[model samples]
Target: MAEFDDILARAADGGRIEAEDALRLYTDAPFHALAEAANAARERVIGDDIVTYIIDRNINYTNVCTTACKFCAFYRAPKHDEGWTHDNAEVLRRCGEAVDLGATQVMLQGGHHPEFGVEYYEELFSAVKEQYPDLVIHSIGPSEIDHMSRVSGVEVDEAIKRIKAAGLDSIAGAGAEMLPERPRKAIAPLKEPGGRWLEIMEAAHVQGLESTATMMMGTGETNAERIEHLRMIRDVQDRTGGFRSFIPWTYQPENNHLKGRTQATALEYLRLLAVARLFFHNVTHLQSSWLTVGKAAGQLSMHLGVDDLGSIMLEENVISSAGARNQSKLGELIDLIRSGDRVPAQRNTVYERMSVHWTPEDDPSDDRVRSHFSTIVADLQQKA
Candidate 1:
């Protein structure tokens, strides 16, 4: 029987591990065996289907953030002219547009606005649900919960319960850049500590809310720090089984306070993706960010163990604000997945298959195009 270390040792030898083993695999194991084992693990979990993506849109409700993290380029302070908030009607318009364009989910993310208390989200979420009951309100993160609690004078658990009761379907892991305190403070000094992030996530999980986990790489953190981030999430996952997926994205280094000096490389991203697959044994879904890394990297990601290609974001602003730029058309995304020898499936927030395209031969024609566009931008000019 193969022990865990033996499996890791074999993976290291085969050039399949890096990042740290990525750091060590180049020197440690027989590269072939390491690659074989990692590949086998990927195959065993994801199988040969080559997982695809969802046609969803990210509707950033507001840019007004109170936490002035050093590494952020998206948040706008209260007095900053760029700071703005989306009202319920505007948020619903975005949801309506997403639903019109066949988007199954709307990733509603924003900063920790000091004044936009729990009532704001409760109203916004309830309105969205009232109008677009079918649209998955996969919005908010732990940071928002923390802020809402502080603003409303409620506890974290209470805030989560109210938001969930209003309409939030699931939480998205946004504020988790690096779980280590040293790196976290260096990058996002105003945000909650690493333990608090996990605690809030665990509370959300216990309250019947499922969420995803994320890591922002290349912020000058050590490779060991990256592994520690994974271990932290893995530990919580071991306890509650609440995290649905683990997404590892490279930090964009353009307009943010943290400049282009130390962005995670493509090879580094792939190594982390592969290592994430190996380390997070209990996490089921591993998503790749085509929006941050280019489509080529996203395609290569499948070979490295990413089962989901994330969303075909009709609109994305945060990373774009930071100077990361990549977009994929619906047709092109399907083609890319097939090109990698995988079936393309559109999934909702919970990974349920809403639609699946087996071959290019079954592609939708011109008549189907209008409806798709309608779902994403029917009321783009509407204000929030």
Candidate 2:
């Protein structure tokens, strides 16, 4: 285990962590030991005793997906009667609700609607920005861009430019269900190729659009594949440095096609978190998957290596449709961070500091700002 110890030492000293070392840590390192090393690395890389959260909402504009992945429960078949797409007015109304509850950012995600193309998103984004000039539209990802390019008969770079010019703030790194070819095919066979996703992201970065990278683990991917995911993202970040953060979350197993047989355990999640902190030395922030992993696990992640607890999501549907039951309010998020013995702060989409909670007096009095209390799906369905 000298190799493992050496890797740990390197991480503690703020040195780079290679994929082989990360694989060993994932396979052999004790849970607590890995957490300690990762926490130390976190302190060196970002800072100790400070955890960040953002106030945002996820707006799934459509449930109709042409490329229905085996691991997804949120997407409806394109011709399925259950399929629904939000109109511009409904989209704006949700944005208004999110802004009313203190969300500065909106993640405009959706399934790959076959009929919609680049111009569709351009008009939607332009309309959103026209109405709500302040709300940051961190919308769509590589999968949507590639799909729209094919539909609109334009190149990926042109689609990204059109969306950016139409007020798309940044790409919401969702299409990366898994980076490796084998598992990516197993889970999301019809989505864009792994290399194509990275190429599109790099192209977007080249055009001045920064985005985060995400990994949806479990669904039967191996430990080595997990490490490989980190390696791919690290290589990209090394080249473009456009990735703002790396957020890895476990797969949810509810209404999905892949059932619950291949779920990643909580211990495994923590191990990956620690390895991520050490492995992603070039990445600026590491966020927990509290929305999928639950609050206790999320709280534990900060001590393990996560510098950010993600968002107090004003609304979410992707993972929720796959059985994410956990929810929290802004005050509760502050308490979750405080319980971990770390200071809590409010951050924007780009990790900019918005507010910090030092004491009870500094807390917001409104406890009703819940993370998952309101959802666009429920509101739209109820109205329909």
lDDT of 2 by residue, 181-267 (tens): 999999888888888999999999999999999999888999999999999988999999999999999899988789988999998
Model 1 compared with the native: what TM-score?
A: 0.89
Which regions of candidate 2 deviate over 4 angstroms? 1-3, 376-384
Could you tally the backbone clashes for each prediction?
19, 0
Evaluated against the true structure, the overall lDDT of model 2 is 0.89
Q: For all the candidates, what are their Cα RMSDs to the real structure?
A: 4.4, 1.7
Q: Determine which window of 10 residues in candidate 2 has minimal summed lDDT.
A: 372-381
My TM-score estimates for the predictions, one after another, are 0.89, 0.97
